[model samples]
Target: MQHAIHPAYGPVVFRDKAADFAFLTRSTLGSDRTVEWEDGRTYPVVDVEISSASHPFHTGTARVLDAAGRVERFEWRYGREAA
Candidate 1:
């Protein structure tokens, strides 16, 4: 452990605008915005575009890529020549 060499780790809110989700957790991330939490305390707010709440994998909205279609498109653009 060292003194005056570590980042400030405290309660901060991660806000996902797309999903309208927010959660408070300890982090070393810096922010200038503040918000009143459910516990009646103010904490720094960090705006994030994507989080687990809105992420495709976590929310089961992930799109399956069509490999066959891509292969066909590629072949059409460039003649198939086995190297």
Candidate 2:
């Protein structure tokens, strides 16, 4: 691997604020923010909108999509006759 071209991969933290969850892992990403881990080490922290901890699929709280309603909406938007 080229030293200059390759990104610096190291330990980082991904935080889900909504669920108050966080985890440390290694990644190429970096952040100005930092947090102290349970292991008594500081790591770059990245705030995420969603993660497996708070994801609907992982938590089994996913909502069923209204497929028929979406079709109707599309038809109405395009002025197409609904069969």
Candidate 3:
């Protein structure tokens, strides 16, 4: 490890807007936005689109894509000769 060359790593807040969830963790990424955490301390807040709280895979809400149906629909729509 080199001195004065590595990005500072400290506590940060990662917020998932969609799930309205937030958690505190260590990160090198800093932000100007700040938020008061449960411990009554302010930390840099980062807004994220998805996290374990709202992720389909983590929440077991993932849906299987209907690829066969999509292919059939596409064929029916474009594969028809000008009849």
Top TM-score model = 1
The C-alpha TM-scores of every prediction are 0.87, 0.76, 0.76
Every candidate's lDDT? 0.96, 0.94, 0.95
Error of 2 at 54 (Å): 1.4
Which pairs of residues clash in candidate 1, taking residues 3 or more apart in a chain or in different chains? none
lDDT of residue 66 for candidate 1: 100
Tens digits of lDDT, candidate 3, 1-83:
77999999999999999999999999999999999999999999999999999999999999999999999999998895666
- lDDT of residue 75 for candidate 3: 91
Runs of candidate 1 exceeding 4 Å displacement: none
Off by over 4 Å in 2: 66-83
Clashing pairs in 2: none
Pitting candidate 1 against candidate 2, the one with the higher TM-score is 1
lDDT of 1 at 37: 94
Q: Residue by residue across 1-83, what tens digits does model 2's lDDT show?
A: 55699889999999999999999899999999899999998999999999998999999999999999999999788888557
Task: Compute the lDDT for candidate 2.
Answer: 0.94
Clashes of each: 0, 0, 0
Which regions of candidate 3 are displaced past 4 Å?
Answer: 66-83
